[model samples]
Target: MNHASLPTTDLRARQARRRSLAFLLFVLVALAATLGGPVEPAVKLLDESQLVHATTAAPPVEVAAPMTIEQLRARVAAVLEREGVPGVGLAVVDRDGVRWAGGVGLADRDSGEPVTADTQFRVASITKSFVALGVMRLVEQGRLDLDRPLRELMPDVAIANDWDATSPITLAHALEHTAGFDDMRFNEYFSAADGAAPRAALAVNPRSRVARWRPGSRESYSNPGYTIAGHAIELATGESYESFIEREVLRPLGMPTARFRRSPEYADRLATGYDSPDQPALFRPIWHAPAGALLASPRELAELVHFWLRRGDRGGPALVGPEALARIERTETLPYLGPDTNYGLGNYGDVSHSARSRGHDGGLPGFLSAYRYFPELGVGYVMLLNSTHSLRAYLEIRALLFAYLTGGRAVPPPPPRDPDPAEVAAITGYYGYESPRMQLFGFIERAMVGISVRPDPGGIALEMLTGGGAALVPTGDGGYRHWREGGTSVRLTRGDDGRRILVGGLTYFEEHSYAWAKTRLFALTAALLLIQLAPAWALLWALLAGIRRVRGRSIAAGEFALHAWPAAAGLAWALLPLLFMHMARAEAYTTANPLSIALCACTLLFAACSAAAVAEVVHASVARTVPLSLRLVPTAAALASFGMTLYLLFHGMIGLRVWAW
Candidate 1:
């Protein structure tokens, strides 16, 4: 299994997207789970002592052959121990049967329960696998049209899109994640309405369902897309999403233990999920089960792998024809991570093993899971972890399992075929991401993940804003292949959109002065931070001066005015991280919550304070009584603060109510 997630599809709560959003957007990532949904909680790692994260690149993987089953288990155990993971449940399978199904380490630190094959772990977004199968079943039965307009299917559901008349949303677009929808807002991410209808779950924030661009234009990983699909399933089948999936997908696969919700009967059977070694992450009900709510054992997940390898068939009538199943595993939209790792329906391709493969990776709260297989190779594996902090360990263990399954044998890359000169000419330019997984932080992300493309002798050179460059060599067809490390993932393509958009690995980027955006935004940000330092130092000086005045020493009132007001503004801004860090545990990114309200109010307060400071700074600077250097300090600080206000105003961040937004 290829364990690493695509930058766009990767869960945001606490992992890849969370940290980035937090860093660029007050690292509010600590505010909740990852960007995809509740599964990827975005927590600032305070308990670093308990969970050593994957900050550095993993050790190089080798495809050494003839690795024994015992060796595989040993290696995985060593990785877990080294990385301080509590436990994991693993299952390896081929067309024949399961080669292994077991667990390692402590399932519960307090209880001393070891992880076992039957230990139930929340599979997070991998629940979508069942939904995908269910949707495909409906397609097979001619009940749900994959390409029919979603508006026609469910007129009751409201979705705002300017291009609705031109490009309507469809079931295939939802399943494929090309519906052009923004992810759920902060409030929606934390919605824990147990037993709520799928439609009601969506009604938490209908505004989030608005499309940033035309439907089916590009793919951005969306948690609610799956949720919306669940609602459509209910409409089509005259059955609830949870009931229908359990009856049609799970039972037919003989996964008796697989379920959508928690039950008292399965209490002891569940693994204790953890965010840290001593700190357990308690399970909370999420609004939509289709997005990330499935709970299953590793043994049951093994059956899921078998179902995929068998081409969506489960012993009896095939859930989907071989052709439809094949369609689900092939990427038609932009690349997710690379050409080889493009996303299909609920499934995505993975060539990290140097062989053609299809699978899904998921995360939520204290759990992480992956379901993968090389259909052509007829082998795959399923992994479920009870801890979220052990990504380094996760990657290493996944690599080892693949080595054991494939005997370290490699597959060759396909022969190269360059795009037509006209096509290449049209695509080579700067582009910015229109699809922000977190809409509140969209402007920040545009600068973060934007890229500049240019024609290269090989094919195209992709330069991302956050460092790293790739040469996309063409691999026949219209798609461009991307190779990184020893494996290839994702692809770059001008997608199904009529706009002739330049599309590639992750996010939906449109032509823009992305380089200019990155350069100007960073420049302004740096200038503001640097300017704030003067006021920060002035505040400290003012504190000492105030003490001296109390002791009967004289100091100029002009200097105090210059220092205090701008200093207050800087301090107010600085206080946010500390306050946010304190509130991280509460995940207070919602608008209704007092803390969330305060969070937004504080930003405006900073602006208001900043505006007031500018006038005081002007008066202070013109005062002949104040020293020239001291006068200069607050003047520069005020200007920077004012500039920042305009920038924030332009991007609509001034009065941002994160949760409601």
Candidate 2:
């Protein structure tokens, strides 16, 4: 048996078997890559600016001077003119009533129609606040219970939870986005059919409704959660969610002008939305009608804010009691995040303008709106913008309002208090984002937002995945009470998997070991470099193959398959996402659409080609005689393609049907 390593034929046969086994493994991986789910990541292909979100600091801007109502209006006009914002609606409120409510700038640019207090704009996610109000109203009336499991209420709606026995999904969990459901899928995002009921939104993509974690354990914002709640409202009452809101919540709170659909009144006074000052943003009729489809003016929003200020009392028998209103503002689920002041029912707690504020920031495509109320000071403001890119203008307007409201009595945060070295060491590590708003984009969020807590002389430096960091100084009670920017804070705990966790104000981060961090770094570097360079290598081989054929020189079958298949694989990889992005922008691209079918087909084809390319490489290495130079690039291409296939397989994206998924 040891006769100088046996005969060459025996050795060759053994190598061929190993090659066959590897090729079979590649085929299995290829099959696995074609089955991705339908969750959406909100890829807006029209505007190029939002594609990059580099650094995030506290949104509130500090001001040096207080202003009168006249000064605030003048400053708003200046901001609109300078920043090229089409229009803005502002409402200021105190304990007594709305102080001022109106608009500044043109509502319709072409006709020069001036914006007024009645010019309605889409309030996007601010619609959730109204949903909470309706639920609380129902809760008080003894029709709906927040504590009852969703399964018992609506047995028809599809929901999958692993912990159904011990902890079932409740109305409170869904309203708070703690039901552990994934956000709406790609097809659901682009499902823009008009007059579709709240129940219709449920059928868009039900597979995404499966819980990713235990119910009520964490908070991840989801539009579908509110829509589901809307359907539940329909089940509880014999009418639609809009009808219920209008009857029980809106009219009772004295906001008769607000409507979920584009009624005749809403259409007449609706402000034209803008991507910028010059570019008009067309209205999208997405299925998240309950979550993001409220059309209300600054004046209507004033009434809504006043309802909160008055604590459910409207001068006639109290609609919803003070305790229910208090429960709406309290964060009871995630005690680790902010205890009593985080994302409660619908209105989240904030510390903008040096004040503890409870509000909601509504951002969709065309319109952006905000509702910030200072409960302690008995004041609040609602600001709405027609243009999506007018965040700076919004901030400026708020800062001016903050100055006028505070009257130079804003309390500054305590400065530079460092924790002990032992405490810093206990908390320092690589922490990954665990609870992502959108499950589809969780990978990207994990990569970009991962933080590293390093000990500093005065405090600890909180460094992000993308390079820059902030040196955080501990001020309040030590351990997790240390304040970062704004009202953001962090605490250490354990995830359900029992991994050490760093719980922040809005995000949950699980600790990553040092070895895992190094491995991830290496993988990231390899993926970035290879995905870019593999195509180049394929391109070079393509040119050579073309030249060989032109000169009438016969190319080997093994060599041709090795290079050619990988080139096809690379091309498919590049075009699939681009095609999806372009297709997603329009309403034509539904799950049943041909383009959606084609996209899935292309993804499957990509995996097949990658598998074939790798199989050829293995076969050639064993049986055929290819030069090192000829084999190197093609091998890299095959490996790179295979790596991507593995990624797709791992993420359940292999047979990704955009429309159906």
Candidate 3:
């Protein structure tokens, strides 16, 4: 008849009903927003930059040549269909004017509606270009210059190589991404607070990694560069990044829909992006304001492109002079292109090792967008999609469509095949991934490899390794290649030893390689690891000292034992794993995350706890055994003291010192 035995059937049913009703209400609200929202105008301006006046009126629009327009539409449709793209919005601009504009498919597939030209898709990293343009606006005003030392603008700033040479980084370098800085984008936005606090630190103080090249010596595409650019823009304009962009770029371009909201207010008209169903939601309050955090419909962005195409001739003074626009478009600085790539100010120029067009391709966790303009043919295209698969499809379709627009031929490639035997054998091995924040090793079993991600989920996330691994054909050279669905590529590098292979910066361990023989030696040495005894010996010395200090005292049995071997053994066991793991590591980089060190420290603490418990059990000294028959309490309390010591130890080991040094 107690509370536990009470029936409470009505209360339980009511609670269940409430949960069900709440869930249904959420679904109904979402449905209402998607299906009942008002249809916005095809080209609505949500905001524009007020800083740069748009003195000129919108340039007269031009219809494409009949043949050209038809070809462009058909090509766009084919690309969208082939790639299973849910929807796309395109803006074509040339020297004459904005030549063609349109949208295809549904912006929201779940809503079962077609994408209007105005359906805003988050433009992802294209926001970086806008940020750069804002900085240039200040330069045009004579408020800032291209070559002034950044330290002068904001003293105590520590951008990598900011003040190294006579020709230090200028506004030009910041705008063009030639500032010798490593690419680091702010990711604090993924948190609930959207990383506001951390972002504040990032804005106030920018850093550059120690570089092999000097500032502006070689270009490296850097998100951190844009973040610094935004910071510098703030200093120049006396505004936050958000206010500056709102006042300078969006207000002038008449882009009212663009905003950096933690949650999109126009969720109904705004296309929702999806990675997997459960991809972690990312928040970036700092980054959302600039580098990769703006959202606008393709239709809105088309107007933005048109504005840029017209060189700011929209009823106001030019947002950017024709000369500055030309500078941004031209290759004033080159991000050291790999064997097959090149980048200019916030835009990739020669992505395919060819000179077909200029634009930037943005790919993040749940977004993909490509904004390009072909000045030669006076045709440009903007492709924005919600799915992760959208980029490849968008690029492929765009490339083929470009051929159609340029009067060139489009020939599709052949299908996939089983991998070559030699090629498969060549890549078979254990590979080590040594990034700054992650250290993992994977072993190839036949064609598939299993990776162990320590202290977290340890398995493959994507079935498609290399994305096109199973489809690749081996060339005469040992390397294998595949024409990825997008304008993307993959290449494998082999060592001169002819056995070692490095894929995606990871070293593959091969069974047939000369290094294979060392595995046996490794196993043998592991079995004979008396090497850990050194730490054990040290622990024993400390234990003996504790015993001497407590000589002749009627210490509790648990306390006496804690003054004996438990503390020593605990320290030894903890150091054992860390030592072996360190032996296996190659080098540490600056970008390493703090979690890696935390895992190792946790191991040490757990070992200490185990040793302390064992000592207490052996001693069995306690006044409370009659109640709970416990033996470890006194020793556990002693180890708790060590546990507190370890908290400090861990922080020191894996903190700012590890990085700042």
Candidate 4:
């Protein structure tokens, strides 16, 4: 009998069967987890210094004595250490006096150079306040009007079409954020352009730039507008913007250390900014100067604040008249920041934890700074850190200010309300919406659950839930509206079956009906199931196996596994959505080892496939001296692979959730 004609134990069929079994095993593992299981938080890699702060309260004790300069220095130093900030400088000002001016930590951590009160730091956007003062000074000098058209000073500048109305852009418009420009443009104006020539380029291309809204129609903070306004002061006075500012504002106020230069004149004491502890060398001074570029010592900055506290008076011609200075204090809507906040001229005013406060925050390459004053409590604070992670520093300063000045009547943190059970139940289902028309919907616990929305060609999509109601997130308007699509409206209808939701033109029957509103979670679940081969690694691997077998006389299991390794990795990729969903859904599940499950699954799958391929070779062994007993080895190997796969599946599902729960 010719070997070609002999009934061939099909190796391909055996391999396919093995792969099918592997897939089934994968599904089983996923199904076990999906059905119901314990969940836990996944492990993460973080530095030892990255503190996990708990919501701990200070023990009952008398409020500390009125904070002295010495007390402030020690407190600030401790805070810098706790935050891993390389260094910091703080200045405290009051109605009658300045106190607690000092710095802490190494200006150069490696060199061990200590930071001092005079150590210079790029004040970042706090420079905007100085620029604002300069602009107002020009206004005081009758060189510019706050409410005049910016186009008048810089003829090349393109004023927004909306500002063409008789109420042309004015100093007030620039100060109040009514100029139809935005933050980054202002940042680029100063930082992007080194000197006058590049700034002149900005004046010509104003229309292509992004604006928060039409000028005077909305309250959008415009950083570029201030820079432009600063330019206008230069244009009108025939003086460079920096020179004009120094002559008009900082010089008159005795803030000698303050200057806007490409590089600090005194680099020895300048605190080197840091991106992070690990990334120590990401510092560059390109287009960062206008918005956050000016360098000043804490003492100089404190004096600047003192000038404002003294109502811009230096016994000579005031930097700004009472009326102009008052504009800096008046609240204007802060659309760029948030609806709940406002800015007056260059200063920020907001209600934090429900207490009214005023301040400006600045962040740049490696520095963060804030200067806030509570007029009601007769206190002010300045915080400057040589690291980007300055939020902790900001909070510490706020806490200190609150403790010492507000008689320890801390602004109460917002109370947590138990989630709406009925709403949760209604929003537990999935829903969808369209885009451009840019719509999205999702629900959970009978209320809206997930908010992750992706836009499709015509609209957007949401997940499914049990309830009929779904949220409609409109991408066009940049706000979510609750409405019914497909023609139905959201109105509660009482029927013989009880109350049901009617939304997007469809009346969901029984509130958990098939035609209920879709949600983000439901969309995501459906997409994951429908599009399981996304990495396409599995399909790609199978195809490659076929191609390799055709291309060569034989194939190596190791080679096949090498090419298909990415597919093995895809098994884990497929489970990520499910893992995240379970994590979010079951709050008790604090940690889940997705990577472990993936590794075990890949190994089991790869091993089973390899065992089958080995068996195929063994069954048709050329030597035939390979005993029938060896065939039993393949069976045993298969059984072991199956057993391991099952174990991983069960643990991945039931064990994780059970352990976490």
Global lDDT of each model?
A: 0.70, 0.71, 0.46, 0.49
> Candidate 3 residues 1-661, lDDT tens each?
1223436885466356546533533443343344334421111111111000010011111222224656666656665677665666666665555566666666666666666666776666788778767777887898777667665765645655635665566556665555655444223223334424213645432433333244554443445556666777777767677777777788777677676554446766766554532222232233434667677777667665566555655453368888877666664543221212234455544223122345665544445676766544455567676645434454455554455455543323333344455555545444432112111111122223322211112111111221222233433233332333212122334433343433321112222322433443343333223222323443454465468668842222223243333333334344433433332231122234543344354445444544554445544543332113222333443344344335434434322233232
Off by over 4 Å in 3: 1-85, 160-169, 185-212, 262-265, 277-288, 307-317, 331-342, 351-355, 407-661
Q: How much does candidate 3 score in TM-score?
A: 0.51
lDDT of 1 by residue, 1-661 (tens): 1123324344333245324422433332223222213333345222111111121122234535437777777777777888878888999999877888999887888889998889999888788878888888888899988888878988888888788887788877778777777766666765565666788888887877787876766767677888888998999998898899888889878688888888789889898888765568867777766888889999989988887777644363366788778777766543233355556777865554556676777777788888788877799998888888766766677777777887766655465665567767777777776767666677677767666777888777787767776677665444565543223432345545444344433446667776587777687767567545854577567687779889977565456556655665676566555545544557777645776776677678668767866877767656565677666767777777777777787888787776657
Q: Tens-digit lDDT track for model 4 on 223-282?
A: 455567666766778877778877777887767777776454586767887766433433
RMSD of each: 11.5, 7.2, 17.5, 16.1
TM-score of every prediction relative to native = 0.84, 0.83, 0.51, 0.55
- The 10-residue segment of model 1 with minimum total lDDT is 47-56
Better of 2 and 4 by lDDT: 2
Model 2 per-residue lDDT tens digits across residues 1-661 = 2224558887567557546644643553353354233423232222111210110244346565546777777778888999998888888898788988988888889889878888898888888988888888888888899888989988888899999998899888888888888877766764456556877888878877889998877777677888888887888788988888888888877787888878874577998888767877777777878877888889989887787777744473266788888888877655343422367777776654565677777766667788788777888888888887656776787777767777667555435464778778877888877788667667667766677888877767777776776666664333332342344355555555666676555566778765666567667667546655655676677688789889976455356566666666766676576557545544435556766776777778778878977888898788565666788877877887888788777776787766665
Error of 4 at 59 (Å): 19
Q: How many Å off is the CA of 145 in candidate 2?
A: 1.6
